[model samples]
Target: MDPLPFLLQPPVFYPIIPYACTIFGGLRPGRMILIQGSAGISATRFQIDFQCGCSTRPRSDIAFHFNPRFSSSDAHVICNTLRKDHWLDELKFSGAPLKKGETFVLLFLFLPDKVKVSIGGHHFLDFTYRLPLKDVDAVGLYGDVTIKELSFLSSNPLKSGSADLQKTPLSKTFPMGLSECQVIAVRGLVTANPDELTLQLKSSDSIPFKLTANFQDQTLSYNSFISQSWGQPQNVQTPFFLFYPERFFEILLLPEAGLFKLAINGTPVNDYRPLVFDLKSIEELQITGSAGLFVVQC
Candidate 1:
């Protein structure tokens, strides 16, 4: 929520073409690689490689090879692995979102089993690893692309070694209580047939705010529990549904100026003014739902 920390390495700006650099901490789940650049007007193809090492004569292994090919009629992306100078089966994704001469922001989100790719802040495609992810130690970018910036974002702070969000009903306590300008981020994956998901900010004797995302009814509502009674529930009027089965999601709640601002997947949703006046009275955060959580950052 707070401008993702660059824990691995400092960002590189305006690097020369055919650049290759060591990945300080290697690849890990929850880490993200962000690239901002544009293709040349006559660009045909460019490749981004996650390699074991930078070897020339012997050619080090490539764990993931992401190649985007541009053409006059159609565009496509090819994903594969290179082991011992031999490429594995290539996976082709048609209708690539990339275009020659167009600037774009690319994001690669590393997960346990697959890598999620986003182009220009929109989900594009996924590439599963053929080689072990832990072996990837360097990254290489080649061909007719001008890179503006490149960075590696830190993984979830709450994550432990080989530990993911499998336990439910997760809760976190704030010793000094919450204050204004603080943000809470919750990221997870919706179950295939999720019914409902609830996130709450609780005080000693009451719930200052509770959000319920009902997938069954396709609605999002919020309320407060105070004085042994539940307040009137209010529905959030969103332009479109934000949650989907088998999809990843991020929820950000920021308390500011006597109200809470909410956002879903980088898009602002709505603000809600709570019944509780004392923001510092909120001491706990709780999440319970049918989704599989990846991280909860306060």
Candidate 2:
């Protein structure tokens, strides 16, 4: 039910920051401006949260009114309901001009866990949390905000490919110490239909793997996904999130025998990719971005 945990996981790329490049673009409550009434919302509860902010704002809270007729104190500000203060340690900002125009860059970073921010070379803040990827939310911008360039540096670097394994096939290189491994590449515009998917991989290793959705017990369901060793499933914030061989691999749904197909970097995979014998659901098959960066899709 809660998206906080999934949101906390570290992302290979920074989430979107609204109006990242414009004359007046920054984190605002809503597109216009969020105001608090006498007895309803208050500035403390509402905010113009950057990528990250400390516990308090002194000079002027990021939230402001857009009516152009009201003072900041009298106006309402939207606030983040999510709790991530402990994970975020430093905040940074830059008013530098854009690369080719009059735009500006407003950058913020949540240190410790991961880095989620943008700006020029000044480099104001450092993320403090350890693998804090789930706490990120949509960027908000209100009155008079402009940003040109946005960049972020993560404290923890994500690993991709078998670079660690010297690009060795999972089945061949991984011996006894190896637990299990599976890689797949699937392509085609995703739809609600189960028959529209095909998957393939290259692995002679007999390791058992499962194909599933990003979220658990919802969206797409299948009866073919089989688990090699259930073991003690780790406790994740998301519902039905089960652990697989890869540390980053979090499966929620499974694919049926005929509904989904497989391949490996464009090559036809017959025995390398695992086959499904049971039913499992796939809310979504993540194959790009941070989740996709590690997974090759064709």
Candidate 3:
């Protein structure tokens, strides 16, 4: 039997400059491949490829190539496809989201329309699937850099049957809050035996608000950790059960007029005051722990 999507062994971390990993059973819709590493300070270029196979005595079939080149004064990303040893017209993007010597998170999120790439939690580029995604299997990386981590997992998780949607328990970072009166929503199915689920609007300095769910008591708690201190945990007991395993649900967070209003499955739950002031300080939206999250939108 094939390995579970989340349980697939991560590719061996490569300290050297070049490496490759076989992506068994191919890619699928609503899947993501995460690559974490740092580019060399003196490096000029690096490339990652989704290929048909890794055989290249003559040349292999490269389904998609994402390459970043920094040649002294010029920096850009090159995208193309290779078939039967012939290269197609190059599509060059003008921005390089990563610096030469900085650690970065590179996410390739596969949705139905396109494969969206993000750098440092910001959307960078989009490439349409010119062919069936399942036609590509292996992932190869080469050029001047070190690979800290590499893994592939499902992006959209199902209820009951797909508890192991993420191998090491999913911890995802998303963007949030365009203005003071902002709304954030998450659509997901909770795990059957979830010990904890934590969602936070955070920044490098402080967390404006945090939502914590403890399944053992079927209780929802809200708190804030600011200025090197943990605030009081206010239990929310309204609108009955806000969490139910084996069921699809929607949760929304709306911030306005010095209060944060929360709703579950489109039902009004409660409103609470801010524990930490200055909502503009919150720049990151993060979800961590054993929750089968499907969609998170701001």
Cα-based RMSD of candidate 3 = 17.0
Task: Summarize candidate 3's per-residue lDDT along 48-150 as a digit string, tens digits.
Answer: 9988878878767887899988877756889888888888888888867777888877888877767888777677888876656777888889998788757
Please give the ranking of all candidate structures by lDDT, highest first, separated by commas.
1, 3, 2
| Model 1 per-residue lDDT tens digits across residues 1-298 | 3464312255566689899999887888878887889998899999999999999779999998999999898779999999999999999998988889998788889888889888876778998888888999899999999997676654432223326655568899998888888888887767778899999999899998999999888899889999999999999868766776755567888999889899876567778987775788888999988777767888
Report, for all candidates in order, the number of backbone clashes: 0, 66, 0
* Candidate 1: RMSD to truth: 10.5
Give the better candidate number (1 or 2) by lDDT. 1
Each candidate's lDDT (Cα)?
A: 0.82, 0.26, 0.71
Candidate 3 ranges with C-alpha deviation above 4 Å: 1-7, 156-298
RMSD value for candidate 2: 15.8
Query: Evaluated with TM-score, which candidate comes out highest?
Result: 1
What are the RMSD figures for all models against the true structure? 10.5, 15.8, 17.0
